[model samples]
Every structure is written in C-alpha cells, then in structure tokens.
Target: MNVAINRKLILNILLFVVMIGVIIFVIRDSLSEIFTELGKTSWPVLLGVTMFGVISQVIEGYTIKNIANEFNREFSIRDGFFASAYATFYRVVTFGTGSIVSEVIYYHKKKLRYSEGTGTSALRMITYKIALMIWALFFLVVKNDAIQRYITNGTFLVIAGIFVTLLIVSVLLILSLNINAQVLLIIFCNRWFKHQKLRDIVDRINNQVYSLRAAIKAFIHDRNAVIRVFCSNMAKLVVWYFLPFFILVQEHPTIDIWLTVALISFTVILGGVLPAPGGIGGFEFVYVLLFRNVVGKVDAVSSLLLYRYATYLLPFLIGMIYVLFNKQRQINHEFKKAKKRS
Candidate 1:
C-alpha cells in the first residue's frame, strides 16, 4: 500500500510537471497574451456555459445509474454525479485510468453490488465512446470540405477513417452479438485487458450475463432511453462546439457559427483520441495546428487556451471541490452507519 501510494504520488507529480512543460512550450511569451484574452472573456457567459457542461456530466452519471438499474441496483443521483466529477478529476490527477479508478471507488463507497457497479460503469464507457464516434463520423463524411479548412487534409482523413471504421465495426459486432451483453462484454474485455483476476471476477458474475442481455435489448427494443441519452449527449456536444462562436462574438459582431462549431468540434474529437489528461497538450496542439490555417497563429493559440480554461481547467477545479466535499460526507455517513450497527 505504501509503495502504491508512492507510485501514485510520483505519477501525479510527473503529470503536473509534463502539463506545465507543455503549456510553457506552447505559450512561451504568450502567457501575457493568453491572460489578456482571458481578461476580455465574459465571466457570466463562461459560468453559464460551464454549468451547462457540468449538468451534462451529471446526465452522464445518471446514464450510468440507469444501466445499473437493469441489474436491480441503484446509486443516488448526488453520489452518481459526484462519482462522475471525481472520475474526471482522477483523469487529471493520474493522467490516465483515473476515471476507471474513480468509478470503482465510488461503487464500493455507494454500497452498490460489485457486478452492478462495474457493469454500469463499463456500459457507460462503451456508450460514451460510441457517441463520440457517431459525432465524428457525422462531421467527417458530411462536413469534410468545410471543416477541413481549419484542419490538415491528412489529419482530417485519418480521423474520418477512424470514426467510419469504428462505426462499421461497432454496428457489425452489436448485430452479431444479437444484443448478447455478456458475449459482447467478454469479447471486449478479453481483447483489451487480458487479466486473469478480471476473468475470474467476470466468471463469478456470469449469471448477470442475462442482465446484460436485458439491458442491451432494452436499449434496442425500447429505444426511448437510448434516444434520450443520445439527444442529451448531442446537446452537450453542441454546447461544446458553440464556445468558439461565443469567444469570437466579442471580436466580430457577426461570425459564422457553423465554421466555429465545426472547427472546435473537430479539434475536440482529435483530443478525445489522444493519450493525454483531459486532452491537455494534445488538444491545444491540435487547435494550434488547425486553427492557424483559418485564423492567425496568435489568435488560434489564444482561442485554444481560452477554450481549455472554459472547458477543462475550470471543471477540474470544480470537480476537485466536489470530490473533497463528497468524500467528507460519505465518510460521515459511513461513520453514522457503523455507530448505529454497533
């Protein structure tokens, strides 16, 4: 346990150091410029927009809870949202796999059955990835020529191909599974993470394979829940895209909303794929490269930084607070329960 703590601490320090280095490398003397643009930003709008983002994140957590319900278990809304925020915060702290760790911790703390909690979290992960791929494909094949002006031909082509392939493969696999949740999950887990211990755990809960099937069938057969989740995610993505337009509104009274949306959305999709914490350096680098083609390099960099602050850092701080408070409350609740039992 001591070794684990030391390793985690070391990893966090390294991630922070790397993030700082990336920011320095990208901004250099432009910190002043970044700050200047930041000062010009409308705080009210930023707050409102970020709150909407947070609400969307809460919806994501609720979506997890809905998946859990299929297995006849549940988590409170507050606990679920807190779990989501902390999971995201974990990503920033660990630089990777923090979200997974956070979910596991939250599940145990919430007293959710292990099968139900892990299953719900896994389903949420799969759905989120699929949703992102869906949006990416829509942008790629449909709006390629327009959005490509901001991004490189090479990069656009690569991203588009990936989304298209994922869409095709996912559809084919789901169809082949015929909504057999366990088979799909087993194949997925085995293909990605070949852990003997995980296999053992999965084998223990093999009965829940029927529950998995039920959930998938509900997703396809019922349709409303799936549609609701899809629409909710789409609305969030739209808000995410609109940030660039709002940022530009301060400069130009009339800006092309579609272009701004396309550019920001494309850049964000790229960040989603990159192996970085909250898509930090990877996101900024993509924006710098792409936005420079359409906007000046300086402004492009500024926009990237602004969006990062509005979308990433601000949420990270809020999530940290949420996690801290939630942890205290959770501990207190547990203590009361123990006292009552005693």
Candidate 2:
C-alpha cells in the first residue's frame, strides 16, 4: 500500500512538472507578447472574470449538493461548496485522469459511505460527460463550416466520428448501469487478463462495479431526482463553456462566439485523454492554436488569459484556499471535540 501511494505521488509530480513545462514553453516563444497582452487587460474585466469564477463554482457545488442529498441526508450547501472546491483543486493538482475520485473522497469524508460516495460520483460523471458531449455536438454543428475548413475532411471526419461514437457508447453504458451492470459480464468473462494474478484483480473490479451500480440504482430511481441532476449539471456546464465567450467578446467583438465555444469545448474534452489532470498542457496548447487562427497574437494571448483566469486559474486559487481553510477548521473542530471528551 505504501509503495502504491509512493508511486501515485511520483506520477502526480511528473504530471505537475509537465504542466509547468508546457506553460513555460508557451511563454518562451511569446514572452513579451504574452506580458504586454496581460498588462493591457483592464481591472474591471479581471474583477468581472473573478466573480464569474465564483458563480461557476457555486453552481457546480449546487449540482453536487443535489446529487449527494439523495444518498447522504446530512449533506448541506456549505459541505457541498467545499466538496466542489476540493474536487476542482485536487483535479488541477493531481496528475492522472478520473479526477472525480477527489469529489468522491470529499463525499466520503463528509458523511457518505464509500459505496454511496463512489456511486453518486460515478452517476454524476456519466451525466456530466453526456451533457458535455451534447454541448460539444451542438456547437460543432453550429460551427461545422468553420471547423471543417479549419481542419480538412479526413481529420475532421475522424474526430467527429470518434465524438459521436463515444456519445453512443456513453448512452449505452448508462442504460446498462441502470438496468443491470452485470451486463459487463458478457465482455469481462473472457480470459483477457493474461495472467491469473491479474485475473484476480479483474474479478475484484467486477464485484466493485456491481456494488456501485446497485447504489446508483437506489437513489437515481426517482424520476424527479434524475431530471434535477441532468438540468443542474447542464447549467453548470453552460456557465463554464460560455463564461469565456463573454470575456473574449469584450476584447474582440467581431470574434465568432460559436467558433470559440466549439474549439475550446473540443479541446477541453479532447485533452481529457492526456495524462495531465484537468487537461493541463494539451488544453493551453490547443487553445492557443485555435485562437491564433481567429485573432492577432496579442488578442489571442489576451483572450486565452482572460478565459483561463475566469474559468480555470482563479477557480483553482479559490478552491485551494477553501481547502486549506477547511483543513484548519477541521483541525480546530477535532481539538474541541477531544477537549470536551477529556
């Protein structure tokens, strides 16, 4: 266990280094350009971006609260806020994908049993991804012309096909999870693990998946809960996707909002496959690549900076501070409890 933990720590460090390196690489090429653009950004715009940053997280916390309440009665808005903040914070800091694990852990710490926490997190994950892809699909359709021209036929076809296929699979996966997660036995029953030791691990995973689905079925069975979850998650996503559009327009009014939405959303979902948490290096790389096509170097850098601060960096800082403050509060609460016991 200690070895496993150490390995995870090392891997996270490497990913963090990669993020830093990518940021440096971007800055290295256009150091003066990036700085000048940043300098030109006015204070009011930054402040507005900061407020939107808070609004985005608050909506996210509310969504988490909605789902968590079904399974964990003790769940409150305050706890939900911290959970959302911590989830974002850890996802930004931690290296590997499946950043929702942090949110699951947050739920467990607050009141949920492991199974309940993991189940709700998994359910929310499916819902959020479905919404994200839907948003991606909508924007892609609206900006199909620009996108197709931007990347020619063969490349465009392959990516669009992949996105469509993933959406189909995710829908099928959700159906299977709700009806009978054992549906996986059809595939996993085969001797795909290669070795007996690995086979044992696969068996363990099968059992865990079964348990997680059962927990999901318990609370998500309610019709109203399901609708609320979907609507809330979609709203949370809209705030995130379009918050930058507002900022970018303030900088360059003629800029194509749908184009910005299409590319950023694409890059965000595409960057998830990278090992970097929260799409670290790949996200900025693709954003700059896309932005350059639409605006000058100064506008490109400035727009991306505003977007990053409004949605990503500012949220990260706020989340980090919330986590630290919560940790300190937890310590104090524990000390008081111990003192009362004594």
Candidate 3:
C-alpha cells in the first residue's frame, strides 16, 4: 500500500511537471502580446474585471452548495468555494482524471463518508460539464459562422461522434446499472492493463463496484435534487460568460453586448472542454482565434488578455493562495486531533 501510494505521488509529480511545461510553451508568445496590451488597458476596465470575477465566484459557490445539497449533505458556502478553489489548483497541475484527488481530500477533511462524498462530487462534475456544454451549444447556434470556421469540420465531427457515444454509453449504463458497470470495468481493464495481476485486481474492483452502484442509484433517484443542482450549475456557467462580457463593456463601451456575451460563452465552454489544465493555452488560443475575426485584432488581444486574467490567471493565483492556507490549516487540525487522541 505504501509503495502504491509512493508510485501515485511520483506519477502525479511527473504529470504536474509536464502540464506546467505545456502551459509555459503555449503561453510564451501570447503572454508577451497580452502584457504589452495590458499597459494600454484603462484602470476602470481592470477594476471592473476584478469586481466581475468576485461576482462569478459567488455563483460558483452556489453551484457547489447545490451539489452538496443533492447529496442531502449541508456544507458551508465558504467551504464549498474554497474546496472548489483548491480542487481547481490541483487539477491544473495534474491534468488527468486523477484531478479528482483534491475533491476526495476535501471531502475527507469535511468528515463526510467516502462513498457519499465521491458520488456527490462525480454527480456535480457531470452536471457542471453538461451545463457548460449546453451553454456552448447555445452560443454555437448564435455564433454559427464563427464556430464553423474555428472548429474544423473533422474536429467537430470527431467531437460530435464522441459526445454521442458517451451519451449512449451513459444512458445504457444507467439503465443497466449494476451489471453494466462491471462489464464496462472488465472490458476497460482488459484493454488497458497488460499484467495478469493488474487484470485480476481490476476484476476485484468489478466485484466491489456493486456497493458503488447502490450509492449512485440512491443519489440518482432524487429527481428534484438533481434538477436543483443542474439549475445552480447552469447559473454558474452563465456567470462564467457574463463576467467577461462585463469586462468587455468596461473597456469598449461601443461593442455589441449580446455578441460579446455570446463570444465569451462559447470561449468558456471551449475552456471547459479542452484538456489543458486551467484551460491555459486552450482558452487563449481559441478565444483569440475566434475573437480576432469578430472583434478587431487590437480589441481581440486586449479583450482576450483581460478576459483570461479575470477568468483564468486570477482564479489560479487565488486558488494557489487558498491551497496554501488550507494545507496549513489542515496540518494544524491534524496535529490537534493527534494530540487529543494521544
């Protein structure tokens, strides 16, 4: 167990390094242009971006709170916000499915049962992704020309096919709950793990998965709870774009507000869909590419920088601070608990 934990730690560290390298490489040229443009940005515009960011965070907090409520577990708004902040920080560095490790840690610290916490987190994440995709699809309808040009036909076709496949799989799995997960796991393990020992371990996982199915079914059965969570998550997705629209308005008051909102909405969804951590390179690249055609080069660059600063870098820095603060508090709490037990 200790060896496995150590291996995971090492693997995570390697992934973090790779992700950071990718971020630096992608942002290097863009950062220079963005910084140059930043000098010309008005103080009021920057202030507006900051204020809008804070407001967006409030929406994010409510979404997490609603997700927690879906589990019939009440968590403080501040806790949810900070936990999410911490989760974002970890995910950016890790850049894999294991980006979920932070959520597990946060739930463990909150003293929630592991199954409940993980199930709730998984549900919330799925709902959040769906909300984000819905926002993206809506913007795509409005910004069809821009999307058509930016999203290559081949790429769009591939994404569409993958999305449909995932939808069908999810529906089938949900319908055939228990056996499906096991069969899926077995097939997944057989393809992925070459080692016989690992294959057997995965078979053991299939057996243990029955307990997880029950937990998931219990949570899924709550239709009202799901709707409440979905609505809250959707609201957060809206705010993601709204905040950027506010930033653009502050800078260039003459711009079409609805179009700006639509553009930002599409970019936010793109960021969420992109695999890059914090959507570092992915967001800026897609935003600049699309925005350049819609809004002029100068405005696009400035607007992209301002938007990125408000939405990505600013949150990243804040999450770093929160992670540090949270880790310190956690260490202190653990020490106290240890002392009490002693």
lDDT of 2 by residue, 52-74 (tens): 77787777677677778877777
Ranking by lDDT: 2, 3, 1
CA lDDT, candidate 1, residue 320: 68
Q: Report lDDT (CA) for all predictions.
A: 0.61, 0.66, 0.62
Best-first order by TM-score: 2, 3, 1
What is the C-alpha lDDT profile of model 3 across 218-263, one tens digit per residue?
A: 7568777667767877776666677656665664677766676766
Candidate 3: clashing pairs of residues:
none
Candidate 3 accuracy as TM-score = 0.70
Predicted structure 3: lDDT: 0.62
Candidate with the greatest lDDT versus the true structure: 2
- What is candidate 2's TM-score against the reference? 0.74
Looking at model 2, the pairs that clash are none
Off by over 4 Å in 3: 1-41, 70-72, 93-98, 149-178, 184-188, 191-193, 196-215, 268-280, 329-342
